[model samples]
Every structure is written in structure tokens, then in C-alpha cells.
Target: MRRLRPEPLTPEAFAPFGTVIEADPASAIGINAGFTTRFHALAEVEVEGGAPILSIFRGRPRPLVIDMLERHPSGTQAFVPLGGRPWLAVCAQAPGAPLRAFLARGDQGAQYARGAWHFPLLTLAAQDFLVVDRAAPERNVELADLAEPAQVALDG
Candidate 1:
């Protein structure tokens, strides 16, 4: 098995795949009588053939071995942690492309670009995530088997 170490997630490192959703002071706006700071437009929701829908995904801890990856060809997918638990986002530019893993903090979220290959959610602990994606009758997921399994190394 191939071993892959996840790097800490940042906007610059993750820009190739998609946007990193988090509260940015540069994009902050004081609203609601200056009591609430709204981090507006952190990520864009792109849909090709369907409307976007909101859903909650409860993820459980799993082994860090990656055997396959999936992608949404018709829309972007966003995962925002509701439980404030760190998680992993594994992605590649295309099928058979070199893979990259990111270790995202609890306060951070990820929005995978349309047609971007990514492994399913890898939660460090049991947690809930607010998901935004397309809702359509047609199947939107495409799966590809990796040439070899990659084991994610969490320890430095």
C-alpha cells in the first residue's frame, strides 16, 4: 500500500481543487446591530443541471486507507462540520492523478469543485456535517478505483 501524509489545510494549498470555507476577517461584515460577524461568500455553490439542496451527514471514524475516489460531475459539493471535529479531505485532479490529502480543522470546511475526484468524508471522530450539493433524479457520482491503496498517515 502507498503511504500518504496529510498536510494542514490552507486556502492557498487547497485552491487547485476548490475553495476552503472558513471565517475570514478580510471578508467579514458586521451585521445584526454589529453583534454578529458574518463571513459572507466563503464558497460558491455551482450546479449544472439541478438545484442545490442542503443536507446533514453524520460521519463516523473510519480507517485512513483510501481505495477509491468519487466525484460529482454536475455540481460542487460542500462539507461543513457541525460538531467542531477535525477531518480529512482526500482529493486528486483527475482519475489516476496523484492524490493529496488535507487535514482540516474543526472550524474549516471544504467545497469540492465540480468533477473533482475526492475520497468520501474521513472524520476523526463521530461528527455531523452540513452538506450542500445538487438534488436531481439522475445519478451524479462517478467512482474510480485507485491503482493502489493509499494509507493515510496522521502522525508526524
Candidate 2:
């Protein structure tokens, strides 16, 4: 099995796949009578033929083994953790390409670009995530099995 060590998730490092959703002070705007700091437009939501829908995903901790990856060809998928718990985001440029794993902070979120290959949510604990994605009747998911499973190392 292949071994992968996840790097810290940053906007620059994760740019190729999609945008990283986080509260960046550089992009902050004060609103609501200057009481709330709004981090607006952190990510762009894309949809080809479906409407965007909001859903909550309750993810549970699982083994750090990756055997396959999936993608949404019709729209972008975003995951924002409701519980403050660190998680992993596994992505690749394409099928059969080398995978990139990111250690996302509890306050951070990820928006996978359309057609980008990524593993399903890898939560460190049982947590709830607010998901933004497309809702349509047509099939949108495409799965590809890796030639060899990859084992993820949690330690830095």
C-alpha cells in the first residue's frame, strides 16, 4: 500500500483543486453595525445543469485507507465543518494521478472544483458538515478505483 502524509491545508497549496474556505483577515469586511466580521465570497459555487442545494452530512471517523476516489462532474462540492474538529481532504488532479492529502483545521472548509477527483469526507471524529452541492436527477458522481490503496499517516 502507498503511504501519504497530509500537509496543512492552505489556499496556495490547494488552489489547483479548488478554493479553500476560511476566514482570512485580509478579506474581512465589517458588517452588522461593525459587530460581525464577515468573510465574504470565500468560494465560488458552480453548477452545470442542477440547482445548488444545502445539506448536512454527519460523518464518522473511519480508517485511514483510500481505495477509490470520486468526483462531481456537474457541480462543485463544498464542505464546512459544523463541529470544531480537524479533518482530512484527499484530492488528485485526475484519476490515476498522485493524490494530495490536506490536514484541514476545524475552522477551515474546502470547495472541490467540478470534475475534481477527491476521496469522501475523512473526519477525525463524528462531526456534522454543512455541504453545498448540486441537486439534480441526472447522475453526477464518477468513481475510480486506485491501482493500489493508500494508507494515510496522521502524524505530521
Candidate 3:
């Protein structure tokens, strides 16, 4: 098993896997008497005829040990944090390749592209997230057991 450190989450770095949703004050469009800002189209929701389902995911803080990963072949999936807390995002180009981690803040969200291998939801606190994903009739998830697990470390 190998240890890996998490990089800061950014739209450019995470572009390969998916989109990073963050409300940037400068980029957001102002509206509502100059009191509201909007970061439009933060992530692309590609369902491809699959029903979009919304669910809530509650997660607790724990050690980051990458033992397995999964992917949705039918459609893309997204996770938007409901609470203000930092969480870890682990992903890889492929199942056998090295895993990369990102530190997502409370305000940030992520949408994984179809067939993107990623770890389950991870967080430091008991935080809830709003998830929008496709509902497929047949099982659309593929899980892979990693031969070697990696311990994810935090980057300063």
C-alpha cells in the first residue's frame, strides 16, 4: 500500500474527471438588488435518459484508506454539500492507475463523469450532501478492489 496526499481542489486540475462547483464572488453574476450571485452551470448533469434521482448522503470523518473504488457506467453523478465542512475526494483515471485526492470545501461540489472511478463520499464531520444521479434499471455500478491501498494525506 502507498500513501498519497490530497491537492487543493480546482476546476482546472479536476477537469479530467469532472467539474468542480464553487461560488466565486468575482465570477458569479449579480442579481436580486445586487444581493445575490450565481455561478451558472457549475457542473454538467448528463443523465442520458436515465432518471435523475436526488438523495441525501450523511458522512462522518474517518481515516482515508483507499481499498476500493466504483464507477457508474450509465450516467454521471454529483454531490453537493449541504453543510459547511471540508471533505476528501479521491479519484483515478482508471482502476489500476494511481489514485489522486482533492480537498473540497463546504461550499464546493463535484460532478463525476460517466465511467469515472472514484471513492465513496468522505468527510471530517457528520455532513449531509445533496446528490443528483441517474436511476438505472440494471445495476450500473462497477466496483474494483485495489490490490494495494493508499493512505491519503493532507497537503499544507
TM-score of each: 0.98, 0.97, 0.91
Judged by lDDT relative to the true structure, which candidate is superior, 2 or 3? 2
Give one digit per residue, the lDDT tens place, for model 2 in 55-88: 9999999999999999999999999999989999
- Residue 95 lDDT in candidate 3: 85
- 146: Cα error in model 3, Å: 0.4
Q: Tell me, what's the RMSD of every candidate?
A: 0.7, 0.8, 1.7
Supply the global lDDT for candidate 1: 0.95
Q: Give Cα-based local distance difference scores for all models.
A: 0.95, 0.95, 0.87
lDDT of 3 at 36: 80
Which has the better TM-score: candidate 2, or candidate 3? 2
Top of the candidates by TM-score: 1
Query: Model 1, 9-113: lDDT tens per residue?
Result: 999999998889999999999999999999999999999889999999999999999999999999999999999999999999987788899999999999999
The residue ranges of model 2 lying beyond 4 angstroms of the native Cα positions read: none
